[model samples]
Target: MTKFSDFANTLQASDIAELLALTEKPEVISFAGGLPAPELFPIEEMKQVDQAIYEKEGRQAVQYGTTEGDVPLREEIAKRMKKSFFVDCEPKDIVVTTGSQQALFILSQILVNKDETIAMESPSYMGAIMAFDPVRPKYIEVPTDDKGIVPEELDAILAKDDSVRMIYVIPEFQNPTGITWPVERRKAFMDVINKYDVVVVEDDPYGEIRYDIEKLPSLKSMDTQGKVVFLGSFSKIFMPGLRLGWTIANPEIIDKFVKFKQAVDLGTSTFGQRQAAYYCQMFDMDAHIKEINALYAKRRDLMCESMKKYFPKECTFTYPQGGLFTWVTLPKELDAKELMPKCLEKDVAYVPGGIFYPNGGNGNHFRLNYSNMPEDRIVEGIKRLGEVLTEALAK
Candidate 1:
């Protein structure tokens, strides 16, 4: 028999991963993965961009680059940080990561030791939990509501637990929940954070995919003490296959992060970095994002409308102002995980909500993603899901 490290021994296929595999069949209308619309990918523009890189930079385009990442891409990201996120940062403050996924793992490794507590919103992003799991840190789920993480609950948690070293949050278009913190809540949350000495990992992958709400100031923008580490991704706005993301932090954190990342993959793809940089220089990115926003908004509306029309009266869900997902809560007696197999029988699927809660037991909720499905599929899938829910409730 083979032996493994304790952390390696603890690894098992995630419930989400298993569920996603089931949904991979051609007939299944899956709302499981947080997938962006592939139809919108700039394939033709990328061909031109690739040709330009090879023609202009030759071997340099594909050569081993600095661990800090491509300078021009970092500069462009700095400009985007100022223009879109309201955070004024320079290229020096940024470190290009493999993806925000890698950043999560490295931050957890560097910032926390075993048994130290990491605070997160109740029923937070499961992927973050997976990333942090390798460190074997204790997790404290701060109470969260429609507006986002409750400040009073977080303040009390922080005041009582000095072991809590880091707090992870997705302020805008939060995964699974689709909740955006209001400016007042953001300020109040920051005030509480200012009183504590913990680092805040502000993951904002879906902030740019807005539909109705005005742009809100990021927690990083309000970070006066350099306590916030902002993570940005090109996946939602650009291409996920490129596997590119960036991190902005205090110089000390950036230094440690770059050194650790050097050990991880040497650096993010050199040619991939140039692809994003050249594409930004040559094309209208804002216009492309606007196009994504329009399509997703239509899908969101159709899904919500279908849910309203077909779902049982006891079911409730969020109509997100912007972002890819709508969070649904079933009546307390019904478990989403239990209902999922029935939905699969109907050739439709959604992510079970129980896995989102680190400490477990919010089994009545499920998350639905609208960005990857067509309008007809969204309507048809919801109708099937509603039937499953209605049948489950009847029992």
Candidate 2:
């Protein structure tokens, strides 16, 4: 007899990885993976952090530590958030996690059950939904536009009943959509959610990567009331391998998360947190980030221009300001999955839009990442993607 329960049989593989494995094509270029620009990682600076930490705090560097996270690093994160995100947070309000993804998962575990309702945007990040789905909560999809989620719709969802416990929102350079909510819209959302008892999760992994326009204040900053749980990641701006991300919230929420963090993994890597602290204190993170923004801006420009020049006139795409992705809406009749086969044959890869939706409904949209490809490669990739797109819509 099988040892596992019936629940184990219902589990499904992550949709993102499933498609990747299914494609199995040799020359793979994944717009699907939310990878940061690896070229911009500060190799020399990281090496220096490792060397200095080992020289001074050698034994502690290798051994286990507190679950709340490295005190100095938590302090540094507090400083950075206060200055950059405009959220008036102290070290005690934060819980450092292995990654922001873990923080989100933990939040779902703590908040949701088979009965509680969680409000999410219609086409939110696939990873967030997958994390929530296994827990089997009643999910309600909030409507969205080019400016991100519609505020009135969110108001209705949150006002419904106590069953709606929390909401997951990606306010800036959101994954898949490549849309950033305006400051005014954010203000409206803050006003609405504050009135209701529902909690809002503001996931901002891509907040710092803005390029074309002036940076806007994050929703966390606008939260005059303690209703928003602000999550930040070092993966995009610093390095993905570090897997460092944190949640800043009121003490009640944070204390619970910290206790849970102790149970989950007993804190993130010690060397990782120490090195991150060292990197922030010594090196110029702003200078490094500026270099990243400039380079990604160039890539976004190249991709947009390439699509305009080479793609079929019917194909449309979003002009993202700061993040890596550029959301594209293919011709109405074209199926993104069907086109992927041809796209892969041409050595270009992109995610079909269907996967981003909570319902797994069919969609004509897809997401592309320009930061990984150089200008020349971007041009060639778009040209190749264009050829497949043209063929798909030709009939």
Candidate 3:
């Protein structure tokens, strides 16, 4: 028998993946996947960009490019970042990634060695948790409130423990919870980081998807000490199929990421990068995002309203200003993980909240994504989920 590397043992299958598989069933109304609506994908626009890139550049469009990513796309990303997030960086400071997902993996690779610590919110993005887990970092769940990660709590944790090297956060329309950090909290968070030697990974995938309020200034914008590494993605605002995202950091850090990225996949798809760049030049992304935001806002409103009507009085959920998901918290006696199959029986599915926690004890909460479904489906799914929850609460 051949012996397998111990690395394989560190990776456990994702429960979210298992839950999302229910989406394959036609009868299953799933809020489990944080997916953009298929109807909203810019198919015709992408077709034009694809043809233009191929016709204009020929083999160059498809050829293997630099590990740092396409210059044009990076410049475009830089411009948008400056205009929106208040962060300024040249194209050279950017490293294009296959997606923001790859950026997270790369950060884990570079920042975390065995037994090193990285702190994140108590119920953070599960995808990020999975990325960091394989590196075998000691996971610390920082306390968070409606405003975002508590600064004093983070300071206390960092002060007592020197093992912590990275602080990962999703301040704008944070995944699962749909919570955005207030400006004061963002400044306080940065002030705490400035006091320490820790690096902050600011993931901003949903920053542009706001429904009502204006987007807040990113932590990178407030970063004065160059301790912030920012990751942005087209996956939320633009189509995810393009798989284009970028990382912005100081040149020294970006250089290391470029070299590390070269070893991972050599480079991301050149054709994809060129096509995205062409599209960015030719199209109005902000206007397109407005259309997306309008669609999702309606769906979010419908879901929240339905939850209000259908869920038990004891149950509560977040009202997202802008983002794909809202967090649902049930009464303490209820277990969302156990309630899942019951909800599935009623042809509705959700991501039980336990998996979102790094250490995995919270089971009375769940996350519902309203972006993937139509308004009617969102209403119906929440209605069914509400029935399940009410029944569980009664029992």
Candidate 4:
């Protein structure tokens, strides 16, 4: 028999991973993944971007680079932070990460020790929970509403628990819930955070995918005390396969993060970094994002409309202003996991919402992703899922 470390011992196969595998059959219309539309990938433009990298930099383009990542990519990211996120940061404040996923892992490792608490929204991103679990930290789910995390509740929790070392949030187009924090909530949340000594990890991967609403300033923009660490990703707006992301933080955290990342993978891909940087310099990234927004917006509207038409009146779901997913809540008696088999029988699928709650027990909800499917398929899938929910409710 083989022995593993304590951390390794605690690990188990993810239920979501297993569920996703089942949804992979070609006949099933899977709304399980937070996948980008592959049809929109800039494959033709990337060929030119790749040729430019090799022609311009030669061997240096593929060689080992500094742990802080490509300077040009960091510089480009800095401009984006100021322009899109309303956070005025320079290149020196940024460090290119492998992906925002890696940033989550590293931040948890560097910031928290075993048994310390990490505060998160009541139903938060599961991937963040997976990243933080390795540290063996206790989790405290703050009260969350449609507006986002409740400031007074968070203030009370932080005041009572000095062990809370970190707070993780997704203020824009959140993963499972697809909720965006209003400006008032952002200010109130920041005010509570300022009073506490904890570090805030603001993950904003889908901030640029908005449809109906005006852009709101990020929590990092309201961060007066250097307490917020902003995480950005190229996966949603650009190709996810490139595996590129960046982090902006206080100088101290960035220094520790770079040193820690040096031990993890030496640095993010030198060639991949140049690919993104060269593409940005040569092409209109904003225009490309506009195309993505248009397609996803259409899909979002279609999915919500279909749900309204097909779903039982007892069920409710969010009509997200933007983002890949909209959360659905079933009647209290019905469990989403229990209904998965029926959905699969109908050649439809969705992720059960319980897994999104780190501490568990919200089995009455599920999440649907509309960005990856076509219009006809989106309508058909929702109709099938509605039938399943209707049957469950009738029973």
TM-scores for all predictions: 0.99, 0.96, 0.98, 0.99
The CA lDDT of each predicted structure is: 0.94, 0.85, 0.89, 0.93
lDDT of 4 by residue, 250-345 (tens): 999999999999999999999999999998899999999999999999999999999999999999999888889999998888999888888888
> Lowest summed lDDT over 10 consecutive residues: which window, candidate 4?
11-20
Q: Estimate candidate 4's RMSD in Å.
A: 0.9
lDDT of 2 by residue, 240-282 (tens): 9989999998888888888888888987998899988999988
Off by over 4 Å in 1: 14-16
- Tens digit of lDDT per residue, candidate 3, span 1-395? 86777988655666666766876799999888888988888889988988888788887888778999889988898899988898888998888899999999998898888899999997899989888877889899999999899999999999999999899999999998999998999999988999999889999999999988987889999889999999999898888998989899987788788888999999998888887788889998889898999999999988988988999999999998998999999889999988877888889998899989998899999999999988788888888988887777777
Q: What is the model-wide C-alpha lDDT for candidate 1?
A: 0.94
Residues forming the 10-long window of minimal summed lDDT in candidate 3: 9-18
| Cand. 2 TM to true fold | 0.96
